[model samples]
Target: MSRLYGDPIEVWTREGRPVQFVWRDRLHAVRRVVDHWVVSREWWKTSDSDPGERRFWRVEADPGSRIGTYELRFDTAGEGWLLMRAWD
Candidate 1:
């Protein structure tokens, strides 16, 4: 099972892909990108404040020596990053 966080995170990218991220004061280095996808909704509605494509990356990351699976999200409209989920 996975736990949902939806917490804001600071991410560093390389060649448009996440290389590392800081979540809850720990720095997680991405070891591998397991999967990727994009989500776009309400295409015709432009007046909304939060309307844009959301890019998702499922990755294996390690903070220190413990590795874990994480899902990260990038919101193009807000230019923000989030730690969406984690597996234990």
Candidate 2:
């Protein structure tokens, strides 16, 4: 399948609770609580620094899908979201 500009990473939830992560219209990986963490830091020094918290997830997609394997970061400011990092 062709990758869309904004490749969708579906955050799956059950009973209104987050359960796992899906990538590119496929089952990518499950979200383990131990694999998730929270970080709070001051970005005031940077031009876009804001007071907020960030949630990080370690996701594993298909066995050999480079683009499929990625880390997603969710921030509180602007309620923004990002694909913080990825690897093959």
Q: Which candidate is the best by lDDT?
A: 1
Candidate 2 clash pair list:
none
Model 1: per-residue lDDT, tens digit, 7-79? 9999999999999999999999999999999998567844476678889999999999799999999988889
TM-score of each: 0.91, 0.48
Per-candidate RMSD, Å? 2.2, 6.5
TM-score of 2: 0.48
lDDT of model 1, residue 45: 49
Provide the global lDDT of candidate 2 against the true structure.
0.54
> Model 1, which residues run further than 4 Å from truth?
47-51
Candidate lDDT values, in order: 0.94, 0.54
Off by over 4 Å in 2: 1-34, 43-51, 63-68
Model 2, span 2-77: residue lDDT tens: 2223344556546633455554455554433335687875666324556677777655555233334456666666
Query: Cα deviation in Å at residue 76, candidate 1?
Result: 0.2
